[model samples]
Target: MPSLVPPVLPGGALSGREQPTLYADGALTLRPFRPADAPAVALAFTDPAIQRWHTHAMASADEAVAWINQWRVHWAAERAASWAVTDADDALVGRVGLREINLFDGVAEVAYWVLPEARGRGVVVRATEALARWSFEELGLHRLTLRHSTLNQPSCRAAEKAGFALEGVERSALLHTDGWHDMHLHARLTDLA
Candidate 1:
């Protein structure tokens, strides 16, 4: 039986084309992950801040390579899309992406992390804004959500700076090594009006 509402976006919306490299204010680049970035990715997972908030660590470059490869698979499956955030020299500064994509609903969740060296420079916020624009304008997504542990002030600020409005909090929505954390939910719609 068919539902009453039609799909918000057609099928093959993302899988039909190559993921494009995105530029942010000429200062940052968002590109598909490459195997060569494994070392930098592996090193980034070692940072205590990244490990704490994300709750997972890459044990080796080999592991990071596998993780990088999965992003391509996710794109092909149309379930998620991720990009490596880089600086002007193409140095890996962090990562950003949309996950849990629901084409019928035109919705996805935004996620990102910044290298320790790139933290204070607003890299994540810039990347998030760029990715949001692409998702709304290019991918035709109607809404994008971003969630973070309530204890993660930096992430909360980045979400707001990227135009994601605070919606509410989820009680004990995510579990970390330390314990379960309350998550702050933020959302951005394609049209604010």
Candidate 2:
């Protein structure tokens, strides 16, 4: 086993099975999202559940390509990275991202969503753990934050399953299409990760 991300800190427990650019457990793979993921990502984002739960913006096919291109730009800039989640058969089922990355400080926010067909399969949980383990072990992040719209119970459950503790709620702080809503805050330190 080796470091999954970068700057593998001294004494970190990195797995030799995980590659520097990506990591996988069982059928799930977490790797840098490429332009090839656009089609699958587009289809998943258009899912109504994803729209209602995650507020995915309406986008045309070309827009999806543009969005994916931005992900690549970020990857090149070392500001952030997105990973496409796949199943045992290597079918794209979801996406996860580590956004607002501050590598020098070892902090990041985890974001993820699974397609309708992928939900209830624990895909998000597995993807999250893979990324978190990389952040804690390879990147040496001290903490990770997860925020879920108060209305999203499933996300809250997923956060808990990923070892996050509810810190509190940001009351009516999140502006939505309908109105303002609370956002539940979840945090986990590297030690817990």
Candidate 3:
């Protein structure tokens, strides 16, 4: 007798979501992950730094392919948007994405990583800034958050450099292979003006 779905959202099937092909900010570009990136993804995930912070290690390119498929699934569901970060030469350097999206609340979480060869070059900072700006303006998100273990000083620095101000620390926020780690929460809000 009644349809209770919100007018702003589709009721039956979720469709009409735009999947971006490329997002560029000057020298950096964000594109969807490709199968060709599996080997690179495998190599990057094997890095001790990536494993320590991200807590997921890929032993082979097959696992990397699976991971990429999972990201595709998430995108199809409108649950997350993942991207491959690249340099001007189109070489894969890192990754940045908006995860945990809440359209109704206009909130999302930002996550990123940089390959070992790309470290110390501000890859993540630039990529994240571009992604956050796109999320705020194009996606109509009001706020974006970045969370990283307090032990990850590099990540903390990148978050700050990307304009995400530290909000607070979440005690024992994440459980890594080592143990529970405190997480620093950082956020950026859209300017309504």
TM-score of 2: 0.84
lDDT of each: 0.94, 0.77, 0.83
- Give the alpha carbon lDDT tens digit for every residue of 61-101 in model 1: 99999999999999999999999999989999999999899
Q: What is the full ranking by TM-score, best candidate first?
A: 1, 3, 2
For model 1, where is the 10-residue window of minimal lDDT? 184-193
Q: On residues 1-193, what C-alpha lDDT tens digit does candidate 3 reach at each position?
A: 6547533323212225556755556688898899989999999998999999999989899999999988878877767888999888888999999888766567779999999999998888888888877776666778899999999998998889889999999999899999999999999998720
Instruction: Name every residue pair that clashes in candidate 3.
Output: none
Instruction: Name the TM-score of candidate 3.
Output: 0.90
Residue 130 displacement in candidate 2 (angstroms): 0.5
In candidate 1, stretches whose alpha carbon ends up further than 4 angstroms from where it belongs are: none
Query: Which candidate leads in TM-score?
Result: 1
For model 2, the run of ten residues with the poorest summed lDDT = 10-19
Please report how far candidate 3 places residue 69 from its true position, in Å: 1.4
Residue-level lDDT of model 2, residues 110-182, one tens digit each, is 8999988888988888888888888887767888998889899999999999888999998997777677889
The segments of candidate 2 whose C-alpha lies over 4 angstroms from its true place after superposition are 1-21
